[model samples]
Target: MYDFNFHKPATLDAALETFESSDDGQFMAGGQTMIPVMKQRLAMPSDVIDLGAIDDLNGISAGNGLVSIGAMTPHAAVAASGTVQDAIPALAELAGRIGDPHVRNRGTIGGSIANSDPAADYPAAVLGLKAIVRTNRREVAADDFFTDLFETALDEGELIIAVDFPIADAAAYEKFENPASRFALVGVMVCRTGSDVRVAVTGAGPCAFRVTEMEQALAANFNPEALKGISIGADDLNSDIHASAEYRAHLVGVMAGRAVGRMA
Candidate 1:
């Protein structure tokens, strides 16, 4: 962890201005990922522009069968939001299951997805539900937002303003978690949002991905039974000390079935 200049601008313009002025500046959203990385000396930015004080970055609104959440809105706020619970209980449950209470209290949706942690919960929800990622300059579709491991489609200076999630006809998330850390060993989010069925998987690959075959099966018949005998080859999936690629590949099917079962 290196010493760095800290800036908490009250406006988006001010934050962007401060961020652009520095050669090595980074945005601090909730500081959940940045703080830990800083402590471990993994990141040494010259300036840290805090987005917390920007009022526009901290609220939740729901309308027209879609729920919009501010970038800086905390995970706890999202989990406890009455509007969220009613509009998308599965999303609320997913938010509640993120890390522990402290992490949820401080970690944010924007920060989580921006970091693009391969095993993160929000990416599944974002992609599975086909959300719109509104940024300072443009809107990115969820399908295009996650580009690779720890990567996104956002430009270096772009800041996410908010995310718009379209309500689904049915949705559920299931994860085989590492008990100690609670990070997903393999997580799956199953959703049928109108005519399309989407199955987004996380923790078993470099980044969360969709299984279109399963999506098609589930789309044809919205039931866990529809997923029977389907498989995802392990060639590109993750193989780690926690779980082997084969095991992870297996868990993907199991979790997807469980997710669909909940919604079935």
Candidate 2:
């Protein structure tokens, strides 16, 4: 790894100050993506501000009809939370299926969403649930937060404080995962609450995005039958050695159907 100064601030304000005071700095939540990149000499920030010491950035709570998850809370914690299971079992299930056990223990939800990896699981849930991303300076709706592949709306020195997800009436997630890495080849989150229906898809494209047609169909029928002839074109999907864009496009519909089929 490149030589760099490290700071573990006890509070968010201190961390922000320390990071901004440096010529170049990056926030470290769980260090899942940043650490690996640094080790490869792909990133050489002047300072690394660790958010782990900030007491307020880790926990889970429910209030005002939403589940608030602290930015620094690890995936394992989310997967095991009874509150998450009771309020949104689909969210917890998605957390449990991210990567492997070791990755889950070290990866944080804030870090994942902030990095905005297209194949990452959190974005699908965030967009599907229409969650609000609470940052240091502002609140960004999930629809506007993820701008593109490996990118987000978070500004320079901006840090995610927490994410608030509304509890849907019924929801489910299904992923077609790469066996070795467990990253989604194509994942779908289907949710229905009152008159609102949402279908968020990931892994097939450059970023996680909602399928409005699928949402409308599901809103009308709210079942696998609703998606009988629906399919997204492969023209804009990611084609990697793991799977062709055509295959990924096909999996999107399959996964969405499965997710809706699994809803209780």
Candidate 3:
């Protein structure tokens, strides 16, 4: 990795102050993606502000019909949390399936959602569960948080504090993972809360997106058969060596069906 000043701030105020002072500063939360890119010279920030030391940004809380996950909370913690398993088992399952043990232990929820990797798993859960992303300044609904590829609604230097996921009445996640990397080639999350039904897909598009057609169909009948004829177009999806756009679109339907089946 290129030479850069590193700061491990113990408080949010200190982290913000250090970021403000640097010409170009990048926040490090678990360093799963950040470190890999930096070593390859993809991201060479003047300063690396490690957020791990900030105690307030880590932990998991569940109550009041919501599960609040601190930004720095690692995937492994979410996977192993008894509270998460009891409240939202599907979410726990999704977290457990992300990468291998090393990635799970090192990747943070905030960093994953902040980086917004098109194939990342958390985005699917965030969008499908209608979660609220609480940042340092304000709360952003899931629909408005993810803008595009590797992009978010977060303002520059605005840190994500936590993500609040409302407990879904029923939910499940299924993904066609790339065997080597374990990244979703096509992942789908289906959830129903009260009368609202949502279907969010990742790994197939530029970013995680809701499938309104599937949602509408599933809302009418919350079953695998409800999605019999529903399909998403491939025009805007990613077409990589791992999978073609059309194949991913096909897997979207298959995965969505599987997820609904799991819920049933």
TM-scores of all candidate predictions against the true structure: 0.98, 0.98, 0.98
Question: What C-alpha root-mean-square deviation, in Å, does candidate 3 show against the real structure?
Answer: 0.8
Residues 1-264 of candidate 2 have per-residue lDDT tens digits of 657899999999999999879999999988889999999888889999999999899999997889999999999999999999999999999999999999999899999999989899999999999899999999999999998998899999999999999998988999999999899999999888898999998898888999999999988888889898987999999998999999998999899998988883
**Candidate numbers sorted by lDDT from highest down:** 3, 2, 1
Clashing pairs in 1: 1-41
Alpha-carbon runs more than 4 Å astray in model 3: none
- Greater TM-score among 1 and 2 belongs to 2
lDDT of each: 0.92, 0.93, 0.94
Q: Which residue pairs collide in model 3, if any?
A: none
Steric collisions counted per model = 1, 0, 0
Candidate 1: regions farther than 4 A off: none
RMSD (Å) per prediction: 1.0, 0.8, 0.8
Global CA lDDT of candidate 1, please? Answer: 0.92
For candidate 3, the 10 contiguous residues with the lowest summed lDDT are 226-235
Candidate 1 per-residue C-alpha lDDT over 1-264 given as tens digits, one digit per residue, 9 for 90 to 100? 567899999999999999889989999998988998999888889999999899999999999989999999999999999999999899999999999999999999999999999888899999999999999999999999998899999999899999999999989999999888778989999988777899999898888899999999988898888989899999998888899999999999999999988888
